[model samples]
Target: MTRRRLLGLAALVAALLVATAAVVTTRLVADRPAAPSAGPSTTPPASPTPAPTTASPTPPPGADLKGPLNLLLVGVDTRVSIPGWEPHADAVLLLHVPAGLDRAYLFSLPRDLVVDIPAYPKARYPGGRTKLTHAMSYGSRVPGDKANPSTAQGYELLRATVSRYTGLRIDAGAVITFGGFDKLVDTLGGVDLYVDQRVASRHRRPDGTMRTLSGGGYIGPQMVYEKGTRHLTGWQALDYARQRYTAGGDYTRQRHQQQLLRALARKIVDEGTARDPQRVEQVVAALGRTLVYAGGGRQLIDFAYALGGVPADRLTLVVLPGAGVSSGGAYRGEQLKPLGRDFLTALRGGRVDAFLTAHPSLRVKN
Candidate 1:
């Protein structure tokens, strides 16, 4: 996948990860297929769902959760069909569940933000500066050297890069593929999206040609959206999240990604996807296919359960504090500042609310 498309998938993965916490229950059967005994596979298991168990009492909505959680949400830019291929991390999000689970903080890192990659034995640069996104590619494979790196190695590089940049460690993480993203959205039926601005996509046409406007230049794919609320299918949502050609560029893209997550969460809860065992099973199955979980399933499930009652309004979205600048010619990077340092300080001290208060400009609409 191209870098931008991969970023879109990152948003999708976050939605799925969060949704799992909302929908999965212990009583829910592990209907998805099992993993290969010998090695890790990108494919999600498909165990059959058993008969329904006794109905349980519904928890009160907006229930507050206990303890804090940290997750490194990474969108892997590789085809699910092609297992074992190390894809670059197109999108990286730091999903933080604070001491009170009533709210969430999703912090985004621009892919072009430059950072120093640590030296890996026999690897390029053995440690040198590069775009944050490249850390995944470099760690994913040895390339022409034929010494392939495991998916975990790629994540380690990414985790280290994020920690170095943001001063927060990833307690757990998951790598979601494009295929898994498509499946989860389709299973959810669709999500409601509130567009901040009009978006015109750059996806190719069915004729293998680029879409164009009446004024002449190519318009790419025609998944256009006005600045209003609308429902998006799995494909439409992905295309919408991938848009980056507007005036806001990556910043706008990140905002839309955050919106997509909120929209998906609302749909999952409002539409009652969490209460239906069969549906939850299907959703979990779809997630299994796409998720390369860093923390095992049980912990994520427990985390999700704690916060499932929380609604979209409680979730907060914030981009890492920075301004975009050119590196020389065409290369671009985000120059982060004292805001980043301050935010990290607050985060480490378990005072995210203080950080947000100090940097009101960093907050975005949910």
Candidate 2:
């Protein structure tokens, strides 16, 4: 069998375990997706005194895993093997499941969105106004140790920053490195995505090799993603999702990322990957390596079961209207338009469905 077919055979097996076992010993860590290649630089700030730990809000054990859940998923571009390197929140997404538990809303926050990141004592970062992506780097610093950054600590501060910005209590979350994301996609064979526009990769060549730099620009045949439904390998999918130089820029990239996510989820359900025990084993092993899941004091299995009812087709991709912000002709960052603020209010009030209904343009048609 082809690698894609072989890997896709085991997708979402954990969700299937919910029906067969009450207590699953298998542990699946939460994982974030891969971010764009040309994302912002992540340099750790100066470390001060070690700050106290600020734990995320966790529900009591055995608490009902009902509807209206918010999950924070982040993709970072950090290489653990490289010492003294910090991670940046390259891709930030919020998954909101309504009370019905039958559907979900996935929305992306602009990495360049300027926001007030509160002081994180753990990283000794005082509150400041900066791009959204910096929150991860500022929070990931290892206090008193500039060489090693803590991804977990970084996540805590990011959680705090996002919660403050959106006014949503994050029930659970996961952080995944770019390599891990690549591995996860490869493990599932590949993903089939609808390319809305043609995107020429800025990083990769036609043969899937890194482009050589020449004359302050990359010189080589580009890996082009044509507009249409295409079966993308792991590298292809990651490369496609990272393109932002196109007409729509980052917004277009965000839409592609969200679409890729839905496509992966849909493939698992549509292909009946859960029935084969061997495939399940393969998928679980891949997930174990790539994901660092935080269940908010609950077990991963609980989440699997609670979310089992949600079908991939019901996953709705939401677009928050925003534009680039500039001052004195120099690009500062990004700010959400008024409509985006209204959507956040709707999310906090648990009326996102109504909000989308009233503002249909915000909902991206599948």
Candidate 3:
């Protein structure tokens, strides 16, 4: 059988590479696909830190490195927000890599999650309750501000907001656009994934058409994906990741994102992308150009090498338990109760395994 068909929560530890290597977010339209032969472009915009040289030191087996690492992964709707569109954080994932770096835990924060945002200069609403996704945009939306809303200042606000919610110190982050993600997938050839159930998307068709359904809901005319093992290109992967209308709703999309996240990391490891100097340079350039990074590329490479051996079965996906509620009779929101509060406490205490053991239901089973 294909890898996707055989895939499950078997060994997800290697999957931690996606977040630990470089927590990514974005959706830029100008992010055209680099030519197949394209080499690294002139130094990518100012990176989180200077790029490392070929002779950079590697961590020794027992080196005294920092303890558990917490990173915030922000995926934005930059593709649909060019020019006149409003940018928002579509996917927010909290990645925790323990000091051991043997396994990883990923927490998906729903975009529609309601939370209190601290006041910041240029924020549309100075300190008020709003959707978690709006924090990034609000940080750079001031009139006459020339800064890009998804860059430096904007991401800091997002990091702060996420840190507040998770109670974990977020040290680094990365933002990748839908377009960049698509191209990256294509660059890796394609990814294979298993679906627990059939999935349909509400995204527009290739011809830019969305079939309207009864009750005013819109989805692809044909089912976007069927249950079983499936090979997905960049575009198809994005569509699959955005299928919130499926049986599990937004929860399903979060699971799919993790699935894709692991699949991509697997492809990178299997292909030895990091070991290849030219390929590494190319990837660094593309990511630096298309995604925003809060940490240096060297740190990302170091973590990737350290965690490359982890098996997929070791990776655990955790979704904060919550329920959907209609707020103000207009916007839909998700509220996590005891589970949310309790999870943060576990995180603060560095006892996620205990927490997960106690509450297995929150674990993503697929």
lDDT of 2 by residue, 84-126 (tens): 8899888888888878666778888998999999999878898
User: What would you estimate as the lDDT of candidate 1?
Assistant: 0.65
Model 2: per-residue Cα lDDT at residue 280 = 56
RMSD of 3: 10.5
C-alpha lDDT score of every prediction, in listed order: 0.65, 0.72, 0.63
Model 1 CA lDDT for position 346: 85
- lDDT of candidate 2? 0.72
Ranking by TM-score: 2, 3, 1
> How much is the lDDT of residue 67 in candidate 3?
51
Q: Worst 10-residue stretch by lDDT in candidate 2? A: 14-23
* Clash count, candidate 2: 5
**Preferred candidate (TM-score higher): 1 or 2:** 2
Q: Tens digit of lDDT per residue, candidate 1, span 1-366? A: 122221222222233244544454322323334444677657765755646789875542223336576678776667434555567776777777777655678877777777888876634537778888888877776656444445566777777788777766566677766566667778899778778788877764534244665576665556567788887777777777767787688778877777777677666655666556788778877777566666533354444445543445666888766677674666567666778767777887898897788778888854
- Give stretches of model 3 more than 4 Å off: 1-64, 122-125, 146-148, 206-220, 281-288, 296-313, 327-332
Model 2 TM-score relative to the real fold: 0.81
TM-score for each candidate, following the candidate numbering = 0.74, 0.81, 0.75
**Distance from true location, Cα of 144 in model 2, Å:** 2.8
Segments of candidate 1 deviating more than 4 angstroms? 1-16, 24-67, 79-85, 121-125, 142-150, 204-221, 296-298, 305-312, 328-332
